[model samples]
Target: MPADSQPASREKPSPAAAPAAPGAGLSAVQRALRKLGLVRDIDFALYLPMRYEDETRVVRLSDVRDGEMAQIEVAVTSNEVVFRPRRQLIVTVDDGSDTCQLRFFNFYPSQQKQLAVGARVRVRGEVRGGFLGRTMMHPTVKAAGTELPEALTPVYSTIAGLAQPALRREVRSGLARARLDETLPAASDWQPAWDLRRSLNFLHYPAPDVAMATLEDHSHPAWQRIKAEELLAQQLSQMQARNERAAQRAPVLAREAGKESLAEQLLAVLPFALTGAQRRVGEEIGRDLAREVPMHRLLQGDVGSGKTVVAALAAALCIDAGHQCALMAPTEILASQHFGKLVDWLDPLLRSRGLRVAWLTGSQKKKERDEMSAAVESGEAALVIGTHAVISEKVRFKKLALAIIDEQHRFGVAQRLALRGKADAGLEPHLLMMSATPIPRTLAMSYYADLDVSTLDELPPGRTPVVTKLVADHRRDEVVERIQAQLQQGRQVYWVCPLIEESEAVDLRNATTTRDELADALGEAVGVGLLHSRMPTAEKQSVMAEFSAGRLHVLVSTTVIEVGVDVPNASLMVIEHAERFGLSQLHQLRGRVGRGAAASACVLLYSANEGGRVGEAARARLRAMAETSDGFEIARRDLEIRGPGEFLGARQSGAPLLRFADLATDTHLLDWARELAPRMLAEHPQLAQRHIDRWLGTRAEYLKA
Candidate 1:
């Protein structure tokens, strides 16, 4: 229920509880808050404030100087209130002729007490205008004789269900309980020996005038120290986990039915020609399957570059080996779409061989899911297409030989490991991690070091080229007319709107409000629809159905449509604010329309001079999109701009974890880290004995993010 909706009586005791109160009875939460590096930076970061001001001074009206901004106590003189029907509420108070009138816009009646007849009170405000009838409108106020401070106050961020003021009080109390000096281990044994006890003391309470100066001395460095510790700890934990997984992975690939023979049989049934890249990737998988050990391979290809085809080959190999295989996707839409394509493409081939496939997902009826699970368990289902639901305990594989993970980056290591964990002992399925985003080799090696990587950099033949152009929003009329003309020609188009929605569940706006506007211009006759994450899963699938089925001439959407939806009928992609997307994302969006053979074109609408802080990277991305359809090149350029964190989704796992390492500049350092990581783990995997382990242990927990 989001917790915040509960009544106060039902509220859990906040971190501000009494134990955190200063005079020595500190609790663990208080200590953690004191040690917390920042004010709610994340679930991990400890961003405690460096210092604070005591907002506890009371001032007299006679002492309030003219033309100064300050908090002062004042007595209310007889009031002459003005109620402007056409304007706002105005109330005045006289502090001996240099009176100030408070101006409030749309004020309610309860606010009248601020200037209650003959009441003396304290107020804080900027003195606007001087002499007779000076003013302070809706400035922060309190009751009479309330103490206020002239020092800048410390504001903090609160976690959900936490209040700002209460949090501040609690933090202050938590600091008291930490007994910073006692909590800090003596620095006698550490390098760069820091007397953290002193640092903590200053953080909690400082000498009068130099409090700010005292904090500035060590606060920033402490923050850096804490962040480094967090990073190291995460690295160590993952390294240890990886070590355990290596030993834990059972032997499934040794069977005679592993992949080679199955791959051959699977390949024999393809109706269309395989691209050279696809063939090469197939050969690699076939070779891996021939090995006695389980195959841990990663297939990285750009959007629409046929990663699924490669995955299908692996699955087919397992099927031929007399075992079942499971394919997992991150989203239901992507899963369903991929599953539909697979069933349509491979069912005919499998039908002749007397085999069948099954599907499972979260939204499926329990009864149907159970039926599929039973079929899979009995070896009646050769291939299972589904989301994470496939890894559930209820669904067991009778002879699970291989696991193909699509959009592998979206799944965590724990999740990736869970799929194989579902298989029986010594029958661990060959693991295949597939990604639509192109990761540079340096980043890939560090992040996916545990697995073998195969890249498909080539596009299939007969694919239409996307002509890219940059145009200002001022040419909307012309762009709208072009869209109308294209719609009239019976061609489908995708109008991609950059992120205008924030809800992760429905974060992609596609073009909600904009779609309404376009609908008005395009008229109700043309089949136009909006597709975004916010719509019910069924609704989104329905929209994709109408568009792919030629019912909708134009489908406006967000990046949600960038992956795995193939409509050979879509001939145009108009990306609004193309400058808003990353290079890889832009390339993916561009790839959407060119799938059809109708000679597709991508119109990149951007703001060149409307001046909203557009950068050279955006222009570079747009130019590159116009220059070539090569995704790898775009990825390389994108890496240069935003780094591999976004593309590889490895920032959290140190995918591109380098301060001194750059995919572009320090390519060698990155390569070195990648090479060293696996080897290091292979040697002293537990790392429980080394100084490196010591440093890493402290840092790894925070890295779980």
Candidate 2:
């Protein structure tokens, strides 16, 4: 919530605040279900089960497998509670067939109240043969529900203001009213493999496997409908955007690509040759320009893949068109970096050839930002680079022709659209959006399908490969000795941790203590600096400045330094407890090194001392990190490992709201969803099918009427 907003419950709630939709009336605490976008009730018969709780059969003592985790409902026969050494307590109970134990090292009095004499309860625990015979440690007990439905019960994510039973009751009410009739048009002849639409049709709801099965993209008959709606929505949006862009003209850069192309001339003078991929994308932008229609494109490449060079070349083309161009970045540091790169790429030629460039940021003096703003308005500044500060109310462009946005995801659709206001609508600026985090196609089609995509798939020839290794924390001394050897050899290294200070409550590394420890042991001679998001902006900027300028040899930092830091000579990136970071982030940090002629290394230090009860995905990620530096490969594996919701930090990306789909395993389904969706929607535009209408109606927020 925004700081200015009042507490939701305290506000004079409007009638509109009462959910006027299918999920509107969930118990107050059940409101979190809306955030997950997973609860939509059908007629009284079908209910949206949040989770499929498998308690259909109880495990007996004689039949219980050793070390197997299972959920069992049993009648508590007796209480055999005893205290062990070191303030430990052993609470044991029997279900007539077998006995299980709950072990607590420091359990308080309140925890004991959860159990009652001869109470019937359900528990999930790991079974092991201990000195007390078969013992289930730390079992979760609850009063069993009456009238068992003889199937898995759904468990919804709990919200603060809502109670689970109240939500379940209310949803039962709504489901009674949410019966699917013929509101949706018939699904086309085509359908995906799965058909778990019981709730939508008011049929029998899904089983656990069936409920989970709905999570495959375009694999279920329901998805055929859902995916089509997503496709049409995107396709419609793109067509509209294309039509709008068609009315505008590409700025004829003051430099053209041919003999008249100043951009080409500048490129010709560059010390390095452009890669084939770079040249191809440049040509693609050029072609978009030659037409009267404005270009709206995205240029995505890995870190250090020469995306900045591509942007500069595009800027050069815009200049040749005899019009102004605006390049926007999300951060001041990134803006300054881009400005520096542009200056390095264009200045020498401009100094000899006679030209001008302008830089703008909030940090600039009031007079400087205003003066630059005016210069930009008068077309005196050929290229303008800045942060969100560029979007200030006072800033305006003179005949803005090309608008290039860096770190595009950080900005919203409204912000991106607002960039056009700097130019007249009749002559809207062409757009070139860039992203370092490579998004999967389903997400791309769902969110950014309106724009054409140009990817930099190939690396520049002769670029050094970044050797990656995953080291266990048990070998910490050896890794430190190696770091010392590398430091002695005059190479810079970056140490990335998830936190800045050691927290007693959380099991994670902090940069401050790590920096202190490293610098103390290495004796201040190695220049260790600590950086984290909690620091003041100016302080963080200064730390980054030091690290970038080579003043700080060992910078221990948080994920704030995960993206867009270019230090060609820095050869080592040591990620302490790499398992804590997302795969995309780890890959981005690795991209920082191996940019220069020097061979780089990315050392992933995980706490292997912690037994690997961790899932297969974490292990797979470690293996993948050790095996390859290909970001695309890592991204695909990442999607497979963490699932989309978890990979992008759900609250930040909203990728998880795609409740019934998996981006990792649905490549074929997604391709088909992308391909056949338009065809399906074209045939039944009204969404008349029962399943299709239910799916789309459930997700109305993602679509506009």
Candidate 3:
């Protein structure tokens, strides 16, 4: 279950147990409601129908179309119970125009009484045609001459043991009991034509006259109102979090007067000059670090944009201010890569100042971990770099002032919070989250509104643009020949597989098998290495080291090297079963190449499934890869295919995503909400809080971390 859908109260009862309130105990039905997150009356009111059924008019049996849903009034001519394939109840009915058959695989004793011979009844269900004529496998039966409903009957999304009629009754009761007063200001121009109660009532059971297209597309006035209100609540919560963080204190990082700053010193000694985009974002982070208010910033850059160097500059400023800094990545390979680069750049600089960089990871030996923990506690490690081990309970920072997270979306809310919580008492460390998978524009506007964002839009000079190609798995031999050619040019290759071992469920090439096959095809003269998550830590490190040092001609691995594996000499990346990977993963894997001046290429080797071709969704991902190398474009296309929830990863771990409003189509509403959120909070603070409470409740608290 989702965190928001769990039970409302978890407290134990007192020994003397007070009298229980009406409907307080969790009956089967109540448990079902709790599963739907319908704890309060307002929650039930908002649980609108997923679709509606039209039973307002009856159609003649002769006029019903095959595979179309219809209702007809007819008289039963024969009713019989038969056993064929299985025991079932079959009823033959005839209207004035024609006749039809009704079959029920599961039926109650009372249903037979309702459909007795010579009885008139009304049935509603899908009609299917066969040699025996039209039939409804299981139709809803009702007495004839009964009054038809004036509005469309709603069919709600439900769980087991809860029928639609029972849910309808509870929804009607809750709708009447829920609060429906307006929360927006009276002068707000963004409000739709309909009021809150009218919108909810109409959406629950729309009139028969309403256009089906309007309801299906959610373009009706009532739906517009619901979407607007939902967007407003989200914007308000984000605004509140931003305002609350503004009041908190953090370490004030500033260079000493009349002295060269460490950031400047590091920049002066670098082998390459900083790109304009990197220099601009570096200054932006530098300004934020000098503030007393803790900086909540997101640094977004495309692959190979020189983000690591900019991060190093920020760490230098924090250290120069007489405080320690820590950087965390999601995987050991990425962490080791960052550790190597930081050590190469800042180790000598820090050693000259009586401080050094430290490394920590779960795979480290006990003695090494203990030594690193002590150095962190004593403030001797000016810069600490590692995977999640940096935030482990055993590690403590004496005066940590900056916390940087690479690939921030890969970590959960609690993990990120735990790192921030490592700061000194009554103060927070400035947070800098970095992501190479660029967030789309609308996503940053809504999901990341609380944090300031800096984009590294330009790659450094001398970086080659990678050419992408799509090939069938049948052409594997041709790809091997291309790899040989690249090796002949003294260039390395990365062959990424989707799996490490053969699985009965998924029939794809594994890293180990691919490694052995490639080594044989390329001759023993070409060295091949295999890297995956299941490999021992030291062994994995050794394989990567060999690849980086130009000792290995081809490295076959899983996505463990998706990010932070910077091998400039490696100019070819072949992804086997590329259709099995997400767009972001495909893009990130492709980025591992094209880091050097040599022309690079990424071959997407895909195989058709049992259906004779890959799925349409997978085709779109592959097409996107072949069409462009722009990370932002890929992200936008990805959002369209996968939706926002999966793209966010663990960032919204306990938070409820937008249920009604769409970030793709509701940008106008989002804009209106953004404009009104701060004003409403300033003028009608109570109403603002009440609005958030009604829609988000405790779910909004997740965004605070």
Candidate 4:
């Protein structure tokens, strides 16, 4: 590599210089580069190649093997257009050792003119056996220009109108203009083996002997250094955001005269004792509620781990303080379920003290909604439970102090912010976000870095482990018979289907069809009810109510019932086409059962193998479900399969984003960065800012959001 093809040397720029101006000239190439969100020279330098191709060692045509990529330097002996099976331009090239044919299905007149007879050309492509001993199809052709590159060539992600050669040239130009300054102190113990500039040089132009596996696996020292720096930048940004949020003013819901007694009373009336994990997490929330600074916390618990009871205790504290508390759910069914459960538990205790519980959902009648709104505004409703309807402008809290969001990932950041804004002027409400879908510890560190996290790791006593079994679709009759037997024993059943309406595109069972099939199979011997998202809210609620009350023997529905519908007597759950759902979703569906004293089992019905083969990914998911009932393990597998992007829901600005760090494999590096971030920020703030600018640039705002 030439020294001139290196970045210029200079001190690192300030925050304002992060977004550099685009280079002049080459308008077409620049336009395509802009599509990749690359504008400055630094941006291009950081735009790492997806893969590298070794083209430095040219080989003889006779030595080339089929399915192998090779670079050949030869002189064209003849050029002709052939039209037997298709019109193509065939150019015969010969080196001193042997000869080969270069075939192009789509050729232009300019290409033909360029590949005239007796012209020397260099080509690189995969070799395949053709009519002529060995052929290189659609090989990249160029006039034998200056000597071939002596190092591995980078194959970058490109856009239309930007050929590989063009991209290579522009990237080389960007590299020549890039100037990197050390973002960390020279005395730091966490420094990389190579300097920033040297690392970039080696990454872009590795030696001819460099192993492809090193670069591809990202295990090379250079790549590891880059990953460490990226993780450190993310950690620093999150720490800064946390500090900012902590500085904000919030309402403090200190206990009134008898708030502690009220909490004790509520707990006393519960059917069972609180588990140790629940008590610990509840105390964490309690401490946060007592603070004047807003509480931004995430309460994570596995299904049936009693997160609702913890949240109810938090609400009791707020209610006892004479301030209104609102609990928001992602869906109407979930909201209704929470409302009913809370009323059952706290209505008796709260109603006697002139404190009422209100329910607001999209399905409520206009008059009912108005009444609820008025009660909330007058502060007569000490506790309010609703879906997104609670965040609407029409609803207001007279003395809102705490906002609790359930299934936190299901709601958008904006919606959560909107609910927080509902509090009184100059007072920020405390936020308690709950998620039943437990995230892996490594992921939670980055995903929920801004919030204090407390995990309810223990399930309440009397909760039996769910026995999961994978049943092929061919065993449908047997599974239906088992369900019938359970129903005849007076135990309720839940049959979950992936889809509500039939989809031609997807060859999976639908809820409606499954309901009809079950009805026919049982034939009045069991009471079967149908439930789906498309049905009227009232009708669905009625069916759910009947099922919970044990009037309905079996309820068949879609994934809408996956979350909040709970019945202790519901001992059996049948999931159709379980392979279509993700691991966390499967776990949530299975969580619906095993909530009661009786032993329970979950049946995962999957499509029969195609030609005696099932997809490896789907097989792993089913095997994991059958192997363990640990929600955290399921979450770890989910992260490994779907990655952090989908697992965290949709991408949003200011969210934590990693370009080089793999949460599955680079967790050790993440841990190192997490440990070092605070100290680095405290002692060397400028260097920390530079690191952030180098890795995230304008996108650092995503994590802050």
Candidate 5:
């Protein structure tokens, strides 16, 4: 059932921010159900069981085996409250063959009365063997003479105040009332053995004779149908978003013939030539901008791949067409880096044409912000670059044609839409989003299906490969000696800590303490600076400036410097508790160095727990970092480790779009969906729209931006 098909009284809230239903005289259970995003019959119909309970038969107590889940029928012989370790209620039950003890650490008065001595009851739980014979820590008790269920009982995931029985009743009612009409045409080639209605019915209450293993691992035919439908819905929604955008109008930024375009001029003035990959992607973007429709292209490359130069070229092209371009970065440090690089590359060229570059940030003083806003509004600033402040309501654009977002995954859906909404009325600006964290192929096909992707697969010439090494925490002294060696050679170093200050929750190194320690270790002659998120904006800028100017020998900071801070003189990176960081983050931090021709190295200093070893997942991340420097490979391994939700970060607004189909293991199904979606939309437009509405509803908005 589509959300739009529900009654008009229901409110649609995102899963993460699910609030109480907007109505009078609602029960606590109803409110709790709303928190789970179950406001519609379809929401309940799609909320499948996490697991099932076997209530089809009862086994004798003598036949119950240890380490196995079983239901046994017995009479309660004794019940008492005991307090040895703690207060508990213990009931001893016996059949003709054997006796078992049922313990409950917490019990209510109703439960006590129901389990009175000599009462017959049927209990279900995991059987465990102990000194007192067979026992169940907490068994579910029920009347003994009731008829067994024909099918397995579903155990749904629910919030407090909504018990499993209550939820089961609601799910059954919703399933009966939901509209399960066939959305796919009968002639579809991708049809599964089970239809949509049959799949949901079988999944919600499976037959007792079915293979539990297949159901648990989601390998059954019913599960396959569900995953296929989900994948198809996602594909349809993304295709719809793309088709709708094609109908909108945007500025045609094609270059004029017989005139040297701004991009060509910038290319001529660049100190370094563009790599083959850069030129290829640049051409791809150039073609998109030339079209009448808005360009929604993603530019992805590894760190040190010279993405900044490509972005500068794109900006130049936009400016050459007599339109404004805005570049937005997530953090101030990264935004400042882009600001400095763009100013150096285009400031003189823009000034020659009576145009200038403007910078804006949240930390800017009132007068500075006002000046930047005025320049932007007056169209004097042909190229604007800043942090989130660039999207502020006060900063209006004049003829905004293109918007470039760096590290786009760090931004939320609302933020990206806000930037895109800054364009003039009746027109949208072409979007060119750049990311240093290369997106894997599967991820690109699914999450980014709506946009064209351009990949800079190769780094620029003369980039040194950084050697990665893993060291235990006990070897901190040796890492210090290595840093000293770099300093001795007139090179700089970056010591990155996970935490900014002392934290009682985490027992890891802090930036402040590390800075002090390194300052004392290297003596007062060496200039050591500390940088973190909590520091004042001016202080962070000053510290980075000093480091870039070679006045600071070492810079100790947090992951704030992980992405875009560049210093050619820096040759070494030491990450404290590297096990605490993600694979992409570690790769980005290592990329901070190795920009210049100097040979660089990254040291991953990690600590072990009381068991004398790091966690398995953490070990995998460290091992992957040491084995490969390829951003694509790291992203692949990262997807395998963290799944797509964490890999995409805030891109999905904290809710993973695909709940059934997995991009990694279900590639075949995903390919089928991708192939069928376009055809369905073209041949059976009504069915495609209904399918998207039924599966996505309000959640489809996340993909549009």
Candidate 6:
């Protein structure tokens, strides 16, 4: 085989081969490999290391430094079992110039025999300062004359009972037996300098002289090549999905047939004007609705960017065309909020035009739900807004032409597909999925490339910039005083806690406790209400209604109120244990306030250690929330902190799992892949599928959504 070509094989194994079931005859190493989801030789070969341990050369004990990992060969001068504080094995080792102590809190009798006095051994671990000069606690030890690696050792993510040496041996065997063919076409203008085989070889067993920084940073040419290939495979998968969706037929929802259509009339009655971004996105949706093919579009906006209005306009287009429309929210609170807003904004105008609006949620009484169901089935409800209840099997639509899903990421692709299935026979409804979480541009290009995206980048006029403050839990009284001041001014406040009830496992504050504490602090002059997921739907709705009506001065709740419980008069937000929440969640919780023009403020009260310190990641999240109200920036930072897989949710399971690519730093590579993927697929169709197979394996089925 050529240097760039894969090793030759008699026949290629299928990428989608199922793994052997438990109880089947398999070696211990093979079972361990299966546990890591690597049943095939190819899978084992592709299971890259999490990091590398540079054990090619041993360091002198005299040259060891604190806070740095070192591998050294030394003679065990003394070995003893210490039981003063606890039973521990202490082995004092000395090289030619300096000495160190190896302390093991857990050890077997066999290890004791191996660490006999005057025995020569090799140990690798971080050198830390200890009372005995230098110490290496729980260091990996190997007897003298054992085979040592000549290159950087791969350290894989493993489960219990799976030793690193055993795993490495299996991976090495797999690599040796694996035969791969070139997935991408031969070198072209856009191709990287290295080939697939060379890149994998470099990644798995880098040369002894290779700098650790080069491998760790993932900036080496070989790593960059592999990253680009992975990104390109993802791009190709998304492009295929986009093309497949485009091939499907859909209902053509033309504009309302009149000088002033229902949409126009509704817009005319709006108290405020639409932002430029909203208008642009509305036009985009309007174009998609006018088309005969199914529309798969994502409307992403910052929290409170008027996505609801844009969706309402799209619903109007469908309704005006003699069809029903449905909007599904993730939670009952959000569904009720949408129902109320649509009723307030479009009720009079739509009612005058002889159309009706209805809502159905899980919490609705049987009679009420039946009435709504009948209204929907009989075509009496022109616009329906609800939670997942709208997509239940018992509920049917008369002429569902459009489905708008709010907080689309919160729902699975299957739910969206099920909603589309509700359309009339031989017609698929145009789908508009809305997300308040602003997806980073790189993710949108790779993960959501199949859907047409419209961004509502501008906030409406009179929207106040929320002043965010990160306060330690020690200053809880100060935050409570500020809330009292806001309440005294007739403005409501939202106090968000991470937990519904105190958990013995976690030390975070709970909504119930916080509510009672606030009530006690504020006294009878302030009305305090508690809301959480554990509360019944009726009670939750009642508390929310009272809060919205200003009957409650402080509404303490859990993340259940994170998304869509909007109250313009609620100008103060206090989130307890804010560090426990994600950046986007913090942003959304903060969005609850700043909806009004009364100088809104959001106080993030976080717990600190006795030293008044927080975790680095948690501190970064709080700082990001305070630095900017821009959801996109926060989302980008969140992605940097949490990564793409978590930010995009499980729907990304089908896309290629990036081994070397950092979405934040390798965005340029993603851009190149996005630009080249379609062209590469069009020009080299066979190679494109192979490339996708190589990266995604059987996971390609995930992109069908």
Candidates by lDDT, descending order: 3, 5, 6, 4, 2, 1
lDDT of 2 at 4: 15
How do the residues 636-700 of candidate 6 rate in per-residue lDDT, one tens digit apiece?
Answer: 99999998778887455444556668887898898888887888667776667767776777677
- Which residue runs does candidate 1 get wrong by more than 4 Å? 1-246, 249-262, 351-354, 499-510, 523-525, 607-628, 643-647, 650-665, 671-692, 698-705
lDDT of 6: 0.84
Candidate topping lDDT: 3
Predictions in order: lDDT: 0.65, 0.65, 0.90, 0.83, 0.89, 0.84
- Across 550-603, the per-residue lDDT of candidate 4 in tens digits comes to 888989887889898789999999998888888899999999999989899999
Number of the predicted model whose TM-score against the real structure is largest: 5
For each candidate, C-alpha RMSD in Å?
Answer: 9.6, 7.9, 4.6, 4.7, 3.2, 3.6
Q: Which order, best to worst by TM-score? A: 5, 3, 6, 4, 2, 1
lDDT of 2 by residue, 1-705 (tens): 321131212111122224656655654444554543434543122333444545555666667798986766676554545544556656666767777776666566666665555677777677788787877767655566534455455555556765666655655555545543332223434443433344343222344445555432235455554444344433443343444455656554444335556686778877888888899999898787666677878898877777888988888877777777788988776787888788877766555544467787777778877888887888778788888777677888777888899987677555666787787656667888898766666656644555789988788875789999888777877778877877887788888886534462242335667888899878867899887766776787898888888888888877777766777768899998887666777888888788778778999988743555545666788888788777667776776777655644321242213544445544454565555545534454343233333444433222211
Comparing 2 and 6 on lDDT, the stronger one? 6
Model 4: lowest-lDDT 10 consecutive positions: 8-17
Give me the displacement of residue 295 in model 6, in angstroms.
1.3
Candidate 5 per-residue lDDT over residues 143-218, each given as its tens digit: 9999999999999988889998888887887778777777876667767989889999999999999999999888
After TM-score superposition, the amount by which residue 238's alpha carbon in candidate 2 deviates from its true location, in angstroms, is: 6.7
- The 10 consecutive residues of candidate 3 with the worst lDDT sum are 10-19
Model 5, stretches more than 4 Å misplaced? 1-25, 500-509, 654-656
Number of clashing pairs per prediction, in order: 20, 32, 0, 7, 0, 0
What is candidate 3's local distance difference test score?
0.90
